[model samples]
Target: MAVQIKICGIREDRALEAVIEAKADFGGFIFHQSSPRNLTISEASRLTALAEDRIQRVGLMVNPNDDFLCELAAHASLDAVQLQGSESPERVGQIRELLGVRAWKAIAVASREDILRAEAYADTADFILFDAKTPPGALPGGMGLRFDWNLLKGLDVGLPWGLAGGLNADNVAEAIRLTRTPLVDVCSGTEAAPGIKDVDKIAAFCKAAREA
Candidate 1:
């Protein structure tokens, strides 16, 4: 199967164009206020509309309440939601029920035990996203830090899963080669600066993912 690619933190027209041109499987929109890449629902709606039927549109939120998720669905045309914070498995189920969209839980991996902990989400989340753990005072994700790819070798996961954290065109092939992740997510790794996505990086990253 071709490796699915989720190009995250995308907020501009050129980035969206690159995502489509590179044949990415998913185009992500951030809704977390704390993140530089965050987009208001109205802003996301416009971009999400561009991705309609072309690629799966994913909305990213961090520890959001029900009302926030409700607003997201009401404003944005999304196919999936990525709960990239400390949300529980039950909450993922609740969000899926609330939005009628596929729900993905972001599991922060710093150790094997963290991977073991993510199993609890398998029953609720439509997919599990393995992202690098953030620093104590840092935002939830998009820090550009990478975990040990070897830590994922032979991981059971017990659910459909994807790899994230510190992935760029240069190292994405190594990541996919090592973990064989069916899907891969990238954000800062494809950026010219925080919140600024580089079209060339986006193109190269997608090219590497598909070739890998």
Candidate 2:
């Protein structure tokens, strides 16, 4: 099967339009205020309403509380929640128990050890999103940095996993070929500027990922 394509960091109606036109599998909304791609609940709600069943709406949060997650889920019209923070496995369980929504936990991987961390969350999360570990004080994600894909070779866990960070149209095929990741996600890879997604780049990334 072809790789599942996800175009993340969508902040506008046009960006959402671009992802849909490109047949992306998932469209991400950053709920963290620290990131430039961050979207308010009102803004995300407007865009979420425009989302169809063809694409999954993923709400991205960083170290969020129960109340915030509840409000975000209610407003964003999300199909899944991506926990991109330091949330513990117990917290992950709590989020799932409380909201009862599909949950994806992002694990920053810089080495094989990082990939092994998926074990703790495998049963708790519906999916595991593997992203590059950024420098201290850097952005939470969408930093366009990459780690070693070979580290994921022969790796197996209970939950499904997706690849992210520094992946563009050109290298996504190689990354997929190396890891054979079932799902691939891109943000800076498809953007001309931070928080500004280019339509052509979006199309190119999707096409390349599909071809890969």
Candidate 3:
């Protein structure tokens, strides 16, 4: 079966067009200021207002509170929220309740214990994101780093899950083959620079993911 693809950290018109044209399953917009890919509420809506009808629109944030979450929901048109910090399952439930929308929790995975930890959110979070654990003091994610795929082998993840971190056209197929991830998310892997999304790369990544 073809794996679902989520092209993340999209901030430009060309990138948005590439994702929509490529028929990606999801497209993500960053709301955290620490990353270069971060976008304001108006900016995210400007880039994705039309895309909301074409594909799933996700808002990516890091450890935001209820007020911050409410502000984004009121200003931006998003189908889901991806929380990428050390948020508890209770917090994930709060986000879902506050927004009345699907909320995903991103876990930094480096070991089997991390996978077990993710289960805590199974009942609360709408989805689970297993991403690479970034080094200390670095941006939360989108750093082009990958964890050992073997750690996830034969593991029973009890909820809807996706893989993120260091996925590109050249290696996404392998990642899919190894993890059998239903959904694969990419950010820096499809970019030309820190935050610049290359349209060609986006197209190729989608084609690779679909054919995988």
Best by lDDT: 1
- Over 141-204, each residue of candidate 3 has an lDDT whose tens digit, in order, gives 9999999888878867688888998999999999999988889999988899988999889999
> What TM-score quantifies how close candidate 1 is to the native fold?
0.98
For candidate 3, the lDDT comes to: 0.89
Give me the displacement of residue 181 in model 1, in angstroms.
0.8
Q: Global lDDT of each model?
A: 0.91, 0.89, 0.89
What TM-score does prediction 2 earn? Answer: 0.97
Q: What global local distance difference test value does model 1 have?
A: 0.91
Order of the predicted models by lDDT, top scorer first: 1, 2, 3
Candidate 3's TM-score:
0.97
What is candidate 2's local distance difference test score? 0.89
Q: Which pairs, if any, clash in model 3?
A: none
